[model samples]
Target chain A: MELKKPAMAGTTESSDVMITLRPNPEGGIVIDLKSDVKALFGDAIEKTILEVLKEFQVENALVNVVDKGALDFVIRARMQCAVCRAAEIQFDWGKEDAHGK
Target chain B: MANELMRTSLYAGGTSPVKMIQAGFYNEDCLVYDLEDSVSAGEKDAARFLVYNAVKYQRPAGKYILIRVNGIYSQELDEDLEAAVRAQPDAIRIPKVEYAEEVKRIDEKVTAIEQKAGLPVGGVKFWCNIESYLGVLSAQQIATASPRVVAMALGAEDFTASMSAQRTKPGWEIFYARNAILMACRAAGISAQDAVFSDINDPEGLKKDLEMTRALGFDGKTCVHPRQIDAVNGCFTPSPKEIRNAQRVLEALEEAARNHTGVCVLDGGMVDKPMELRARTTLAKAAAAGIKVGGVK
Candidate 1:
């Protein structure tokens, strides 16, 4: 699904990551991440974001993540929520895990 | 969870992750992580994720963990059940269960999920909240619908609303529904739970309500706030005097049994078959509550 409008999810609290997704005319994905542990896990976080976007088959979007020491599951859950809201899609249980496939 | 002294099933809103995590330390028999009614529409997805992660990682030891999913007719029910079953809580409480098929459908879904996840087939249980007039009418059928059903609780607020009656402190409004649910549970041999006493500040009122429900044969009650846990747990636990009386009756029954006599006298009364059963049940309740009984170790 493609982004209908800008949508966001998650909180800025510790062990969480706020994810915001916006439409992009460029027709390719771009990721911007800010994290305290960026120096140690920046590449890993960026890679996971791209991987999730690819899995959702979104070719164009601007993904913004502000991290507060969140684990991968929190990041994944937040990303799924943001994607679902942006695309105006239901989180189909048959096709997704508890945190979304 | 088997309702052994499941006195206070304290509800912790899924939005408050810290409180949910800290619930087990409060000594409440059951900690209910609530994702329905307590969570707003916008935050439903987030709360589901949070509750799932909490149940998977931070669930406390020695406390029964139950998750309250949304109603069967709600759009969020599927996601809620998916999360709850995958989280593997002790039980998943289905809200506003008005028919037997609701429990059967959820039971099938849970069993499928358990199989896919490689968990034991019947490891997860179900708790049905009979929250409407139809639910009360169909309580017996619902209780007997699934072997996974461990307890059935009355939801007085909605039920009273459905009946077009106002809630009163004396509980005359929900008295019949309460009794009906108790009778259904008794017939099905499952635990019966009472609804929450919403007046959090009124300890005396809570005590009165709890006493009434306990006397009516409810195994436990729901609590919205942690402060109410003391009264809920205490009311369900047998008192010292009651425990002593139960012990004396058991002793008399034992003596009678040894002498091949079916009748025995205790405390200036005749202890017969019914009295013997009551005493046994009392001792069991005391033991479940971790109370010490004289002459019964």
Candidate 2:
């Protein structure tokens, strides 16, 4: 269960944002997201998405999201599962490792 | 079975001191305030008095009271039942019901008590705690015992101890037990409640378990803390999308029935009886949440 810890995902809120995150062998990560998601979701979806990613300990990753009338519940469920898959949910991406560790 | 909204119940009587803090705090769902644990063996009499008084007239809206008396065969349990029948709670919760005969045995007592009280002979339902080795093995028989039986459950801690399972949280290894109880309950036309997560402080863990329980079609869950009420409410409440999905399914099904078709397709799939049962549950959640899910039958 050894996952290389070199990945990153940046957050964006414009409509048409694509969220994608994965491992890059070169030691960093790529984050790609379209900008239109914010327009589609407004405040609730944005808050849920951010909370889901960080709660599942997704750090050092790339993300791309395409919003098509998705709500906060949908975003949260999807992002939580995706982050679980990406990070194995094995680390504390929320705070400094030692304090959380 | 009711063909309309039935009140799904959440259980809250613990073997230790536990209580729900307010009215329908778990979305004002059904509450079974425990007399067994809240009162000491010395104070069991007083505890039953308090619970009976609560049940008699003061139960809040959206809350129904059931007394989790001591296990059905205990001497203390016999005393608790006598007091409970005098006050007349909704259902008698018999812990660790391992056999069909246990239902018959408890039924005899309930019948005698109901007869003596002359309380309109409601038959006061009998259900099982399918929580031990024998309980799981004989779930189907126990569930089918009598028409008065309404549900089945696996007391996770006791069942886990019987299985020698090693998990930090309560439900980690008991998903099979849960499903077994659920299947047998459905087969016998009854509801199933998932066991309590004993750690009251772990709201996240509680919420996660209750969410999974709801996803798996459990009508309700047992709880040991009032703080867990909000978590259970959040986990079990239907989102707008779920209600909309239920609405769509109901409409499609009604159309198909008009055409004399047994199945209807919704969201690129066929909506059949099983899916209808699930949709009905979603509808119940919407109803419980005070959101109108139209076309519910």
Candidate 3:
């Protein structure tokens, strides 16, 4: 789905990542990540964001992440919220099932 | 999670990943991942997704997990139900429940979601929050509305507001509602959970309130902080003296049975059916609390 607008989810709390998604018609999923654990888990965080984007079928977007040592599930949840808010779509359980599949 | 010890159902904010990750490590018997009052209106969607994923991927074991959804009439109810049912927590707690019809409605919706998601029908249980005068009056009907209703909690803050009564530490204002809810739960054969004490700083006050709660026959209490879990659990657990007395009563009954006699006596007093039942319940509670009670099964 194409992003309709810019939206953000999560916070700068101790174990959360604030994810911001903007519509990027030609950027092809550009990520700007600022995290204290960049040297250790940067690739894993970016990969989680990309996986959520793929699950939501968003091929082009600018993903801005402010990480505070969040886990993989937290990242996935935040990314899903951001994508759903940006795409102006209600969260569908069927889509979640498809993602699980 | 039905029939499990739910001495303290602690709330973890649905949007806070820190609390959600650490909630299970606490000694609380139940973890209530709250998506209603703790979450703001704008963050409702985020909280739903957060709680869903938390329960789906990182569910904590050995604790009763409950996802407290929004009110039955709210716009967020549908999405909350959809995500909550799919996540498959032990139960979904419906806040601000006022009528039996509301419970039935939510039960039907949950059944549909379970079917669509290929989950077992009636697998999802419910905990209703009776927080109003109307709800208290209809507590019996609400408790008996659906077979999946395993427990009902009294939301004192809302209930007092509904009654226009002053909230006090002594909790005289909620006395009637407490008994009403307790009786209803007893009549319906479901667990009755008491309201939160709200004052986390005063451990003495909490202890007093828990005394009243246990005396009123409440099975458990809602806790806002993890520090209160041990106190609540201890208050609900059967004491060593009670356990010993229960064992003696059971032993007397067993001896009578072996002697082919119907008379059972303990401590110079005849033990009746009610005493036997209370003793059994005491032993059961002791066992559930992980206390070693000898000479009793």
- Model 2 Cα shift for residue B167 (angstroms): 3.9
Off by over 4 Å in 3: B1-3
Candidate 3 CAPRI grade: high
Name the best candidate (by lDDT): 3
Model 1 C-alpha lDDT per residue in residues B129-212, reported as the tens digit of each score:
999999999999999999999899999999999999999988999999999999999999998999989999998999889879
Overall local distance difference test of candidate 3: 0.92
Q: How high is the CA lDDT of each candidate model? A: 0.84, 0.61, 0.92
- Model 3 chain B is weakest, by summed lDDT over 10 consecutive residues, at B1-10
TM-score of 3: 0.96
Per-residue lDDT over B1-297 for candidate 2, one digit per residue giving the tens place of the 0 to 100 score: 111222344554322211333433554355675765454664454345345545543454545556677775666776566657655665677788888998877777777767766655655665467768779888989998877688777788889888898655646588888888989988988977777778887777776777678778786676665666666666667888878887788888888888997657787887878778878878877786777666547
Q: Is candidate 1 or candidate 2 better by lDDT?
A: 1
lDDT of 3 by residue, B1-297 (tens): 343788889999998999999998999888999999999999999999899999988888888999999988899999999999998899999999999999999999999988888889998899999999999999999999999999999999999999999999999999999999999999999999999999999999999999899888898999988899999999989988888889888999999889988788787899999999989988888888888777655
For model 1, the stretches where C-alpha displacement exceeds 4 angstroms are A1-6, A12-17, A21-76, A86-101, B1-5, B292-297
Off by over 4 Å in 2: A1-101, B1-27, B253-273, B295-297
| The best candidate in terms of TM-score | 3
Candidate 1 Cα deviation (angstroms), residue A101: 15
Error of 1 at A3 (Å): 7.2
Best by DockQ: 3
| Displacement of the residue B282 alpha carbon in candidate 3, Å | 0.6
